[model samples]
Target: MGTTHDEAAGPRRRSLLQAAVGGSAAAAAAGATTLTGQAAAAPAGTAAAPRSGGRFDGESPRFALAVLPDTQYLFDADSADPDPLRATFRYLVAERADTNIAFMTHLGDVTEHGTEDEIELAADTFGELDGKVPYSVLAGNHDVSGSDDQRGDSAYLRAFGPDRYARMPTFGGASPDGYNSFHTLRAAGRDWLVLALDWRVSDNGLRWAQRVLDDHPTLPAVLTTHDLAWAEDDGEARLSDNGRRLWDGLIRGNDQIFLALGGHYWPPGRTVLTNDAGNDVHVHLTNYQDRYYGGAAMIRLYAFDLARGAVDVETFAPWFLTRDPERRTPLEAENVELTGPADRFGLEIDFAARFAGFSPVPAPEPRPASDVLVRGTVAYWRFDRAGLPGAADEGAPVADGRVVRDLSGHGNDLTARRLHTSGDGALTWSAEHHVGQPAHASLRFDGGQGPDRGALLSTRRDAPLNATRFTGGYTIETFLKLPEPFVGEHAWMGVLSWEGRSGDAGKTTGWSTEEPTCSLNVSPERFLQFVVYPHVQDADPTSWSHALPVGRWTHVALVNDGRRTVMYVDGSRIARNPTQRSTGIATLGKPFVIGGTQFAERYGQGFYGWIGDTRIVDRPLTPRQFLTPYR
Candidate 1:
C-alpha cells in the first residue's frame, strides 16, 4: 500500500492535489457539468442501450479497451467534482462506435477515503455509464481502510461489490468476500477474461482467482489490480514487494495471463517478464493523478489489432480535450496527450501462435484437386502427393527425372531436371504452403546465379500445351514465398516461362531477342515481371508489380482478355500494368518450362524460392476463379 514517494517525500499527499481540488470546484461553479449530457437513463440492473446504429462490432478483428486509473483526488469528500470523470464516460459513449471499444476497466483508487459520502459521490458520477458501456472497478489502498480483502463490509464494498454488476453482460462472478471479481468480454470472435483483484488480496481471494481461471482454461486473461509496480522519473518500472508476491502466487505460472495492469504509481512505466511457460507477460503501470487537475481523468486506450498482431496504446485526457484550444492553460495543452515511450507504444504479439498452447487454431485441410479445376483450365499442377510412385516425400530431394502428372486431365505432364553443377539437394518437397492455398505442400528450390546452377521442371517436347497458343484469352496463377534473406545471387530468377526465344518465334518487339516469349520472373529489386510476346502484334506487353515482401506468401495472377492484359498481386491489380494490346502467346512448339526460364533455349539459374499450386487456363478468369479464393 506504500510507495517510494512515501519514503522520499514524507507522505503521498501532493500540493498539486489541493490546487486541483480548488480549481475543479471553480470549474464546476462555472457550469462545467453542462458539457456532458444528463445521467444514464437506466441504473445498473438493466440492459445497456445501444448506440445510434447498433452495439459495438465485437466480432471485428480490430477493437479497443479503455483503462481509467487512480481518480481518488477527484472524489475527495468536501472538494469532490464529478465533471472530469463524467466527461471521460461521455467520450467513451460517443466514440464507442468509431473505436469499437469492447469494455472499460478501472484500476481502483476511486476515492481518497473509505467514507460513505466519498464512495456515494463516486458511485453517482459513474451512473453516467451505467447502461452505456461495460466496466469493472476494484478497491484500491485508498478506497479501503488500509486492510486486505479479509476485512469485509466497508463503504467501498457496499457501493461497488458484485451486486452492483450482477446484471451486466460482462460480469462473470465474484469472490465470497465481494472484494474481487471477473468479467468475460466477447471480442475478436472469441472470449477474453478480465480479472479485477482487490488491493490486498487474502489467501481466500487468491484461491478464488485461481478457480476463475481454472473454469475458463482457454480464454486469454488480463489481471488488473491497484498496486503492483512503481517507477522512477526515468519511466523504468520494477516490481514492488507486493507485486513480487502476486507474480509468484498468481501470474508466473498462468500461461493465459498475458497482460497485467495496475495503478498507484506515477509517471506510467511498463516491463515484460517471462512466465513459467516461457512466454512474455506484459506488466504495465498507468496512473496520472500527479499531472494537471488530478490527471483530468485521463483514459488509456489499448487498441487491439489482430490482423497486425499488435496492441497499440494511447493515453489522453478527454476532459482537457473538450476545452477551447485558445483558452487552454499550458499544463492543460501539454496533458491533452501523452507522447512518452511508456504512454504510447505498441506490443507485438503473434496472437494465433501465442494462444496455441491453450486454444489451438486448427489448420485448414487440403482441398481436392477437382475443386479448383475451372471450366477453361488447361493445366493444373500441385506438389501435394508425397508418397506417390514418382513424387518425392516431404523434406526429401526430388528425383532427377520425376514426372508430375497434370491434374487437369490433360497430357501436359512435367519432368524435373537438375542443372549441370547442382547437387541432388537442389530441389526438395516441403509441407509449407499459404493459408488459403488449396494444396498442402510446395517445392523448395535452392538455386543461385554464380555459375548458373539450379533445377527446373519442363513439359515434354511433344506436349499439346507447348504447341497450342491461347488466342481467345489466358490466365496464369501461382503461389510463392521468397526466402527471408534473399541473397544477391538469386536476382533475376525465373518462376515460369514458355521455352524458346522470341526471335525464334518470329517476334522481335521485346527487350532482348534471346528472352523467352512468355515468362514470369522476379527482377533484381524483387518486383514481379510478366513479359509476353504476342502473336497478333509485335509489341511485348510487360506487367511489373510492386516489390514483393520477403519471407511472406504471395498469390499472383496474370489475366489477359482478348484486348489487354492485367496483373494482380493477392487479388489486387498492380499499378504498372502496360496498356499494350496482347492477344495470343507466341509459341515455338518446343516445350513449356517451370521453375526456370531458358536463355538461348538453355536453362540457366533456376527459381530460388518455394512455389505452390500453379494453374494456367485457356480463357481469362476472374480473381474469384483463381486457385486461392480472393476476399
Candidate 2:
C-alpha cells in the first residue's frame, strides 16, 4: 500500500483534533471562533446541519459542564518539598485557562494531605478558576483520606462548588458544591447526570449513589468514575471489578445510566460501549499521563444540542494544554435523532422536539428494519512540571535492543524479582507497608535529576535487543498495599514502560518503522490519570502500553486477546479492547522499569518507587484469580 503519504495530514490531524475537543486552536478553527458565548441555535427551519468544525457550546444553554483532575495537589506538599505551586499552578491554568474549554470540572484528589496550608492552597487554586468557567469537581480516593472522611474538604467546597444528586434547572444559576460528588445537567431537552463516583474511598460511596438514583428513578444518566471501570489489564484491581457491587447497587440495574466509561492515562483514548439495552453511550480516557509522555494526555471537546439531540465533536490539540483528538463516531443513537418529541402536554414529555423536530422523512433512503448506532471517544494530556526527583536518572532495567525474554526473571524460571525504589523519593518506604494502608509517599518521575536525595530507579532484566521477542499480548501484574479508607495520593498502582531501545524510545521502530509502539507510563500522582492503557493500529506495525495502581499491593495487568483485549485489577477484569490482536508476541529487549517508566516525562526515565511479587504471565487472568488469595 505504498500510497503517496500526506505530510500536511499530521498538521491537519492536529488542527481537527484541537477544535474537536474544544482547545485553543479548536476555538480558532471552529467557524464561530468564540468559545465563550453560546452558539446561537440556528433557525429551526434551516437544515439542522452541524457546525463546520463539528464543535458547539452554549453559555447558559440548558446547562454547562467541565472536567478537572487532581485538585488536592494544590496545597499538599511532597513530604519535605515546596516548589511553590510552580507545577500545579501551571497545570491548573493549562487545562482550565490557557486553553479554552466550555466547562472545567475537577477530577478530585483535592488535598487530603492534611496540612492546613496545603488545604488552603487547594482552596485558593480552585477558587482561581471559579469565575473563569463554570466549575464542577468530583471526590478522589485522596479527597477523603484523613479522619473527617472528606468533611475536611469544606475548603474544597468553599473554593470550587458542590454536587451530589442535584437536578438541572432550565434557567441561569451557579453549580452548588456540597453533599457528595455527582450531579446532572440538561443542556437542551434531554437530561445527563454528570455522575462522578468516589474513587479509592468507601464502598458506601456506591450506596450513596444508589440512593440518589433511587430518588430519581427515571432520569437517563452518564456514569463517570475516576478509576478505569473497564480497564484491559491483568491482576484485577479496576473499580469495575472491585466496585462491581457498587455498580450493581447504582447503575447496572437502572435505565438512567445511558453511558458508562471514563478513565485517564493510556491509549485508545476514545471508546464507546452500549449497555444491555443497547444505548449509544460514550466513554473517554487520555494520557495527560504524568509518567511516560511528558505532555498533556489531550482531550476532545464535545458539544451537544439537546434541543436538536445533535452532537458535534471536534479535536483540540493546542500548544501545552493538550486536548485529545476526535475519533470516528463508532456508535450512534438508533434513530440518530438529536431531537425527538418532548410534549409538555398532559404531563407527557415527547422526545420528538428534543431531537430538533427529527421526524423521519420517508425517502427510500437505505431504510433498515430498525435504526443504527455507533460509539467512540476523544482524549489526550498536558505535562506541566519536571524538576522532581527521578526525572532523569531513571532508565528501563532490561538489556538494550533485546527482543522478548522471560520477564518472570532469572534462568527461565518464570519467577521475577520486584523492582524497588532506590531511596529516590518518598516512594521508597523506610520499612514495608502492609496491604490496604494509606500511603504518604510517592515517586515523582519527571525528566530531571534535580536537588532531591533519591536514588536511581531501574529494573534488573537487561537482555539483548535483537534476540527479544516481539508481536503479541503480554501481561505484567503489580502487587500493592494501599491505605484503608483509600483516598488522595496514598492511592497507588500503575505500569511503567516497554521501550524498544533508546531510554523511552523504540530502538527498532524508532529507527525504522513508521508506527513506533514504544515508550509507556502509568502514574498515580495525577489522580486524573490514575490509570493507563494505550493502543494504535498498524503504526509501522506495533503498539506498546503500561498501567498501575497508586496504593495497595494489588495486581495491575494487561492482556491483548487478539481483538478483545482485557485489563484486570486483583484478578478481576476491568477493561476490554476490540482492535489489537493477541499474537503472544512482544519486544522485550527493553526491561520493564518500576516506580516509573524508563524515562520520566511525568512517570519516570526510570522508576523511583517499590514493586513486589511482579509477575509477567503469558495468559490472561480473571478477577476470580485475584480473589483466590495468592498461594
Candidate 3:
C-alpha cells in the first residue's frame, strides 16, 4: 500500500514527516546560550512535561518510554548546530527520574556516516543518558555506511558496546557483541521483552530473535528496527524487505509479539496486522530525517496506560521550549508543528484479548434465515451452492453446483457471472474459509481477467429493490473477508452498488453525476463508505473509523434513518453522517450488482475476496441488531 503526496516539500516541511523537522530561531538561541541557561529554561526535572495536547488530554501514563528517531540529523556534516541533539539527550537525562519512564528506545541511524568521528559524537551524546536510563540502540542503513550495501564494520560496537549496557540488570542479551539486542521491563503485571533489531539483520539475527521469543513465551514482546512499515506513494501501508521477512520468519507466528516499531521512511505511518492466532500486532513507523537542518529536536513520548489498555503517543520538542515563546506555534495549536495524524494519536490495545489464553470458537454455527425474516429483510443472497463442504455440488457453478438462494424469499436470485474457476475442470470450493457458520458457502471473486469481471449480479432483470423505496430508513449488511494483500486502491472496489445506467447520461445523483440510488463500498484505507445519490452535502459520504482487518471474517452494516446514516463494523458503530440530507435518491431503476459497482459505466474493477451472507433490511437496524454475527 502507498500514500499519495507531493514530492515537493510543503510550505513548512522538506518532506512529509518533516513537518516538525524545521530549525527555528530557537536552535540558534540554544546554540548561543550556555548549558546553564538551557537547563534553567525548562528545568529538566519539571521541564515542560509532554505537551498535554494529546488525545488523553495530558493524562500521564503509569509508565512511559521515549522513542528516538534517527540521530543522523545530529551529525550531518552540513549542519552547524549540534545543540538540538545534545539538548534532546540532556532533557531525557533531566526527566529520567522525574517521569516514570522505564527506558528509551532508538530506531537506529545513530550517526550520519559510519565514520569514527560521527560514531564518537553519537556515543558521547547518547552516553550522557547511558546510565541515566535503560535504552536500546538499533543500527540503521546510515549507521552501517554511506549506502545500504556498503555496511560499516564494527564502528558502532566500538562506540557503545556491551560494557555500556552490562550495568543494567534487565539487559537480556545482544547479538554476538553487536547492537541488535533485547531488554526486559516489568509493567502491567507483566515482563516486556523489547527487541532492537539491526538495519539488515542476517539469517542468524532472525534465528536469534526467534530463540529469544521462544525462550520468553510468557512475556509480551516489542520489536524495533531501522526500517519496517511505511506508506508508499499510494497511501497504503507496506513492509520493507527486512520487515516482511521478519514478520514471515519471526513476528507472525509468535503470539507474544504485540508491537513492531520502526523509522527510516520519510513519513510516519501505522498498521495493525493479526497474527495466525487472531492477535493484533501494532506496527508503527516514525521518522523526521527529511526536515530542514536535520529536523527540530522533536521526539515521541509513548505513555503506556497499561491498566486502560491504551498507549497515548505524544510528540514534543524539549529544545523548542527553551526558545522564545513567540517563535514557535502555540502549544494549543493542534498542529504541534508535525503536520499529520501520525505525529500524535491514541491506540486501544487489548492485551487480554491477545495474551489471555484466547482460543478460536471451533466450528461456529450458522445464522438461520428466520433471523433475517423476523427483521423485515427485503432481499438476501446466500451463495450456498458454491464451496459447499463435502457435498456433491461443492465447487460447482451457481446453477450447476452452488445455488444463489435468497433468504428473504423475494425471488431475487444472484448470478455468479464471474468467479474463480479451478484447474481440475471444475470450480474449486474452499472448505477452510467458512467462519461462524459450518458448511455455509461464500462467493469468492478473483481480481484477475475473468468474464463478467468477477461480479455477481441479480438474476432478476426487474429488481424492484432500490434506495428510493427506503427513504424513511434501511440497512445493508454483509459478512466480508478482505483479500490478504488488499486488492483495491484509490478508486472503488464495489461491495454492492445500484446506480443510474450509462444510457441515462443526463441523470444525476446528488453526490455524483452517475452514481445514484445507493452504493456501499470500502475506501482505499479499508474503511466502509455508504453513499446516497447527490451525497454532495459535504457530509453525504460517511465512512467508518476502523478499517476492516484483512484476511479475517468481519460483519459490516450500513444503516440510514431517513436523515442520518451510520456505518458499523463487526457489531460496533464506527461512524455516522455529520449532516443529515433532506432529499433522497433522485434516480433508482438500476439492477443491484455485487463484488463491484456501476455508475456512468460498469465501475467493476471488482473486489477480490469472499462475501458470505448479504442482506437488505427494510428498516434501519439498531446497534444491537448491527452487532449480530453473520452466523
Best TM-score among the predictions, by candidate number: 1
Which runs of model 3 end up more than 4 angstroms from their true locations? 1-61, 78-80, 146-153, 233-236, 328-339, 358-631
Residue lDDT tens for model 3, 225-341? 887877643334567777898889888898888889888775677788989887788888877666544555567877778556788776655566554443444431212245356
**Pairs of residues clashing in candidate 1:** none
**In angstroms, how far off is 452's CA in candidate 3?**
58
lDDT of 1 by residue, 385-459 (tens): 721234556779988888877889888988888987898778888888988899888888888888888888889
Report residue 576 deviation for candidate 3 (angstroms): 32
Instruction: Tell me how candidate 2 scores on lDDT.
Output: 0.35
Q: Please identify model 1 stretches exceeding 4 Å from their true place.
A: 1-55, 324-327, 374-376, 386-390, 461-475, 500-514, 530-552, 557-591, 599-602, 617-631
Pitting candidate 2 against candidate 3, the one with the higher lDDT is 3
Give the TM-score comparing model 1 with the true structure, all chains together. 0.83
Candidate 3 yields a Cα-based lDDT of 0.62
Query: Residue 134, candidate 1: how far off, in angstroms?
Result: 2.2
Residue-level lDDT of model 2, residues 134-230, one tens digit each, is: 4455545544444222344454444434432122232122222242455554444344455665444344555566676766555655566555433
Worst 10-residue lDDT window for candidate 2 reads 374-383
